[model samples]
Target: MNFSITRLEDWQQVVDKILPQLQHPILLLKGNLGAGKTTFTQFLLKNLGSTDEVNSPTYSIVNEYTSPKGKIFHFDLYRLKDLDEVYDIGIEEYIDNAYLCIIEWPEVYEEELYGMKFHTMNIINSETAREISFE
Candidate 1:
């Protein structure tokens, strides 16, 4: 499915629409800088009952949040130089935990992620709106 968000408030509708289809534990977010990946993530976390602050894991690599359902691991692989760095940080361990794993810049480790089952969302941004397509 695809959705268009022309305002920040539209994020809630997108979140609501996608929440029911979250059969997989992993979510792979694809987009360019300023494409609202983090913004969409924050909305998702909030809708999941997370009261804590949600921010990009750009420097930290991963950020963990607690929701009413369980733990959520948000990962940003943008800074990793290679797949070795992902292993160094124990990404496999987290991926095996059966919790929600929201990943940004997953293209960085595309080969490693090939076997994993995840909900992929590609966000395309225009001058006044953002288009999100789920696959």
Candidate 2:
């Protein structure tokens, strides 16, 4: 799916459309700094029935939240320098246990996902709007 929107509330429309299409546990979010990746996540978690406050996991690396559906682990791999750093965090264990994992800046760890089934979304920020491509 592809979407282009200028307002933040439009994220809910994107989330509502993608929510049912999400059949995998891992969702790789690719975007540049200031893109709406975390913004999209907030809408997603809210639509998933989560009441917990949502925030970007940039510094913490990972943040945990609960929803009626199950546990959700949000990850930000932007600061990780290597795959070893990714492994050190026990990403596999988290993915194995959580119902869903929304990973922002997934480029660093995506190679480890070979042979794994997961969803991918890319957000491109343009002068006028945010463009999203999802699969």
Candidate 3:
């Protein structure tokens, strides 16, 4: 489904509508900064019944949250200078745990994404609003 989010509230609505239909364990949130990527994630985590604060994992590389269904792994690769950085962070171990992984700054290792579901979002301002796409 596709969504056109004008304000922050609109983005939240998109997340609310999409969260319940998710059947995949992995979601690749592709978008530039200030584009509502993390904001959408916050909406998702909250709707998933997570009470913990949802912050961008930029400095820490990864942030984790737990819900009744499974662990949610939020990863930021913006600081990573090399593909090996993913390995150095024990990504394999995380993937093995069946956690729901939400990746930001995925361009760095976009090709490295294998054996997982793919979802891309872009903030489009051409129409006097932000546009988000999901497939």
Give lDDT tens digits, candidate 3, residues 1-52.
8887677778678877787677777777777677777888898888888988
Point out the worst 10-residue segment of candidate 2 by lDDT: 8-17
lDDT of 1: 0.90
Cα error of candidate 1 at position 38, Å = 1.0
lDDT of 2: 0.95
Instruction: Point to the candidate with the largest TM-score.
Output: 2
lDDT against the true structure, each candidate: 0.90, 0.95, 0.79
Highest-lDDT candidate: 2
Measured against the true structure, the TM-scores of the candidates, in listed sequence, are 0.95, 0.98, 0.89
Off by over 4 Å in 1: none
Q: What lDDT tens digits, residue by residue, belong to model 1 across residues 1-135?
A: 999889999998999999999989889999999898899999999999999899999999999999998889999999898888889989888878746999999886778776777899999989878999987
Q: After superposition, how far is residue 40 of candidate 1 from its true place, in Å?
A: 0.7
RMSD of each: 1.1, 0.6, 1.7
